[model samples]
Target chain A: MTVFRTLAIAGLLLGYAAVTSAQSAVDEIAKYRQQLQDGNPADLWEARGEDVWKQKRGPKGVSLERCDLGLGPGVVTGAYAQLPRYFSDADRVMDLETRLVHCMVTLQGMSLADATKRPFGSGTNRSDFEALAAWITAESRGTKMNVSISHPKEAQAYRLGEKMFYFRGGPHDFACATCHGESGKRIRLQDLPNLTEKAGAQLGYTTWPAYRVSQGELRTFQWRLYDCFRQQRFPELKFTSEASIALTTFLAYNANGAAFNAPAIKR
Target chain B: MTQPRPLLLVLLFVLGGCATPTELDIAKQAHEVMRASFKETGQATLDRLNQDLAQSACSIPPSTSVNKEIAATIEKENMASIRYPADGKLLGDWKSGERIAQSGVGKQFSDDPKNASGGNCYACHQMSKQEISFGTIGPSLLGFGKLRGNSEAIQRYTYGKIWNAQAYSACSNMPRFGHNGILTEAQIKDLTALLLDPASPVNQ
Candidate 1:
């Protein structure tokens, strides 16, 4: 009995030490984020995005100033918070990136291929969409996410997004829910947000268009989905496709009531 | 790689759905959207969108649920697909297994498909007590062999379970590493030893 008690005390000490180390890592990461938050590199992208939005460089020599972002023409402020909304003109639901593509094609006289030539950027090659998304999403800093689902098409998109969220496929047979379905879960120290729950949904959805420190690029929501699909072993998700918009709509809608805050920083 | 599944598996998956025709239609439409929205890149192809019996059965949204009855059928099919090692050797070098477990290089579109894939066991599992930074998605495997003695039966069970977790639990989140070709027979053998060898750090 005495030997067993001694062993139990040793186990308790070991467990406490483990907990301390894990806590320290988490705390260190938090501190690093706080430090990085003061001078986020997303600011550079925001500046470039704003300039491009106002520049007249396309074939029609027109700026995207007159582009409608579901809040009427050229209204940048607080527009992203209400995105993935049904557009009567397009007759479909579109997210921020898709909407930007539409504006580039229709208003700026850019061809579809040209508009979507580079949706993501590698080092030294910047994506216009990322810049535009950074500026546009930055404009909606504290606006409450209030994505609507009133129209039939909007409702359809939401339902489709819901299904896609749970759709299992690919070599790994992973769904978005596979990683984000449960609370208090981690994937090699990276905390996964439970997107099904309200708090998790809000936290996850509202913090995209982040400046990924590792990649040294400001990534948009569209990029997030594209990269997730790549990691899931699914084929490359199109730059801005119907499925991407649908999934975004679902997540954005689920994130309703939380204030949208992005063009943030991430490791 | 998996053997071509019997046609009956698809039928069982369809019959397993408790959702109404409307819900099924939504799922179908969602599938179509996915099919149309993805293009082949690197090792990932459009064929990745294809769902097997277990995938279709397990893909229940928050608003929906899976059919437990279908789980048995899925498990049976997956169990039959698990091939044992040719030499009947279930365990390999635990040192190599430790390296495999630590590595997360596999199957991503950015990954080189020509190269060997890692088990990436540490990403979602706590395999060794010494590895302080471990994931919590899956159960801890510390002292796995110590807790469950390394009998011949245990060796076979560990090897098979790692090969295809779905063979045991129909909708298990653990990847079908061996069945899906994410890990080779040799790699899986090494992983088996990592989990069940008495001298392995996991058992220590």
Candidate 2:
């Protein structure tokens, strides 16, 4: 009985080894990602967002054509690449989501509360902000990131953002730098990009605004920041807060020369 | 083969002195901006942003390395925070330890306040040979008991280290499971046994 049991265990181990060695989990995930790249779901969001942008449905019944995004006004192409820039009218640094909210409020006559009601999508409740951001960011795909920090406020935002990146807090005492400051480091299998350097910043910053397969939702850079703070064990980051804009300014400025490459798919 | 340039040295020193204040100014601004941006939610209050001396020292910019002197100071202070079991018992049921090591839940804002916390050891360690799924953030403890033996000192060291990882290695990425109130003394004992018990899967 002992011999038979031993043989059964050996056979099971051999079978498990064959199954795992056939294709490691990482390889399988990579292959899956490659396949997913063929037909990204972000394209669907882009179409939906384009419709939202052009459709006149707000209380003011105005299209967002007059809303400027650091490019004069009504220009969609290559505008996102220069965003999170200083807008003199607002006298503040604004990322794409904040700018969109501003346009929704000012142009479309939407209340701030109403505009930000559904900032993220889940299940059947799709977010207009996320879809709009996906479409707007897609407009700048393949353009080199050219975010300017020449303005005094823009420069201040960048500096503040850099500081916040290193700010440690919470029970765990983790700053963004803890996970992403070093080159050639990863947490588990997730490759943490070093946001302080050019190569890492470019790769990390430019490729975001991605379609997260796990969540099945389009995530904006603001959503990205909000979620990161949650994992960092910090309190909830207010949407489009000063710190959010500042951090976005810092990261976007660092990604100055890389080509914008999303709405891309991510695992 | 170059001669000493006293004039050049003077110029360099002046430029270096001019650079320091700007950096300090920016750092002050960053601190204020961050303070204004976050809000309290659930158990994560705004006070979490306030750094203790050890935390501030360890929170150096990525461009800088951890100062050895400061790190050592942090280690010394953290070592003083360890509270051994009052009854002096160190070992616990390794079976319970396994469960604590496997669970990665606790202390997040989203977690239930009343529920007991977990050590989440598997998130950054290979505690047992049987568990194929483990993170690589920290070292593997596959043969921990066989290698370290079940000495009284080993048991005590294991318990204390799990209680406050920073006690041994300052600024360690590992959480202060006990020191930070993330785990109970009983939970920590189970984890220590997970590493030092002869009958534990880690020993096998």
All-Cα superposition RMSD per candidate: 7.5, 9.0
Question: What local lDDT score does residue B177 receive in model 1, on the 0 to 100 scale?
Answer: 91
Best by TM-score: 1
Q: lDDT per prediction?
A: 0.86, 0.80
Badly placed stretches (over 4 Å) of model 1 are: A1-20, B1-17, B62-65
Tens digits of per-residue lDDT for model 2 on B52-108? 645555555642355666567678989999999999999888999999888866667
Pairs of colliding residues, candidate 1: none
Q: Candidate 1, B2: how far from true, in Å?
A: 8.7
**For this target, which candidate reaches the highest DockQ against the unseen true structure?**
1
Query: What TM-score results for chain B when candidate 1 is compared with the true chain B?
Result: 0.91
Candidate 1 has an lDDT of: 0.86
List candidate 2 segments past 4 Å from native. A1-23, B1-22
Q: For candidate 2, lDDT tens digit of each residue in A1-267?
A: 234334444543554454443225445545555766776778889999999999997899999988899888899999999989988878888999899899999899999999889888886898998889889999999999999999999998988888788877677777888777877664544567888899999999898789886667779899889988987888888888899999999999999999999998876
The DockQ-based CAPRI class assigned to model 1 is medium
